[model samples]
Target chain A: MKIFIDPPNSLILFDLVERFGHEPLSVMATIQERVDNLEIDMPPMNVTLTDVKNGLKYAGIEVPSGIRGRLAVWGPLIDQAEAAIIMEDAPYSFGCVGCHRTNLLVDFLVRKRKLPTIEIDYPRTEEDARNMVIRVKEFLEGLK
Target chain B: MVRETRLVVISPLSEITPDQITRKVHSLGYEVTVKETCYGAVLEGPPETVSKVMQELRALDPLGIYSKIRGFPLGDPKRCRAQHGSRPGFSQLQTEWQSLSLVEKGLECALRGDKAEDIDIPERIPVKDLQRFCEEVE
Candidate 1:
């Protein structure tokens, strides 16, 4: 299964996904592809020049392009996923997910995609650690 | 150059005190806001300096430190405001902490490797040779 891990830059999760025999979708890998392949010339799909000029004026009807620009990058990854492992409150990892605005947008995107998802909080204790591994292993095994 | 604001989490798996860890990292020369939550202190600061402080803190409890870089620089007008900005409000800090606590624990489980007794395991994880890593940094 293609496992989309949140805080997409987490090498730990990236390694873990690979260790479990699944492909991990991470921002680090995505950015590297863009940089390596020279895909930087295109415009972001979620935002347009009109949206930028309008800003947040329409409230519920529209959003700031900053959020959209990010959504454009991560949204496709979520769509390609068969299952997802999302970590909340990871405002410390090296990904766009750490930013509050992007975090919320990603969460909404995950929900909308409706893939088989397992959400976990970042762990702090041995017991929490044990549960985390158990849950992750279970989620991965479930994919089989 | 715009300063990058980083949110760093410290959580010692063993019995080490998080507050003491906070005090030790605070003494380092970076201007940061240290908030101690359930998972650990979330230090917001510039990226380069924060990297320096993290080296020191990681030596104290290597597996404990986990950081996520933020999009907005520290004290950006868009990020600071709740009234106009889409960023999360201060009330959400606790919520974010609680949520990331899971990420912290999950990180330990994933990164800790199967053999805690093997020193090489520590090396493989971020800590790299626990005692030696600390000594070199010190």
Candidate 2:
């Protein structure tokens, strides 16, 4: 299945659609695009964010205790994602220290549950998203 | 004359000559200024262009390149050290340490393998400690 990983409403979503074939979109983007197209509204978006926020608070993902409160507030939706379009220049993965820390929880889930995975080449600029998606499409094409 | 920063290449007298260095510097669009310094030589231009010229010069002779040179704004040496020392990454702990009241500091110090009573402290208490004390008394 083609995957579009949307981590919170960040640019990685667009990059993912660029990388993987966009036949079926990621759930988060579908929600955002739906909202944009007037099919959904802010009320539903707020509700979804709240639900994801609460779910992550109780998930018991560990970091230093000092950082946990902030993480619990911002981390849930990102952590819950089964897949993602990791940006090449993002502080986390490309060259940042926090990259592995953010991916640690989900990586564990993939190992234990045998989740299908795709690691897209990092996209550096907004314009690169198109090429990134095409690359993803080529990758999926190879699978077929 | 517009003052521009550029990298000046210097080498030991035995290594390279004025003519050879001048040709390389000119090719990189830098005018060699002083060529007879003990270390090597100097060039002048915009800081970025000078940096590129410097890199090229370094590549031309690796053993002769003693330091990575770049330009930055100059400031008061003491104030610069103080301002840099106050950066959040390092000064945050100091702030936390200072913000603690004598009792809290005592408590923290005690937890860290020191006797709370043994630590000498002045009597002024922080409002946070006073509020905590009031709550306990109530």
DockQ values, each candidate: 0.07, 0.01
Q: Candidate 1 chain B — worst ten consecutive residues by lDDT sum?
A: B114-123
Q: For every model in order, what is the iRMS?
A: 8.1, 24.8
lDDT (10s digit) by residue, model 1, range A121-142: 5655556555666577667767
Candidate 1 residue A40 C-alpha distance from true site, Å: 3.8
Over B6-34, each residue of candidate 1 has an lDDT whose tens digit, in order, gives 45554334355667667887677567666
Q: Candidate 2 lDDT, tens digit per residue, B27-138?
A: 7655434243333444554446655665676576543332212121123132244755421212322221222222222223323444212223388999999999999999
Identify the leading candidate in terms of lDDT: 1
List the lowest-lDDT window of 10 residues for candidate 1 chain A: A38-47
* DockQ of candidate model 1: 0.07
Minimum summed lDDT over a 10-residue window in model 2 chain A is located at A88-97
For each prediction in turn, the share of the native Cα contacts (below 8 Å between chains A and B) that it retains comes to 0.09, 0.00
- lDDT of each candidate versus the true structure: 0.57, 0.37
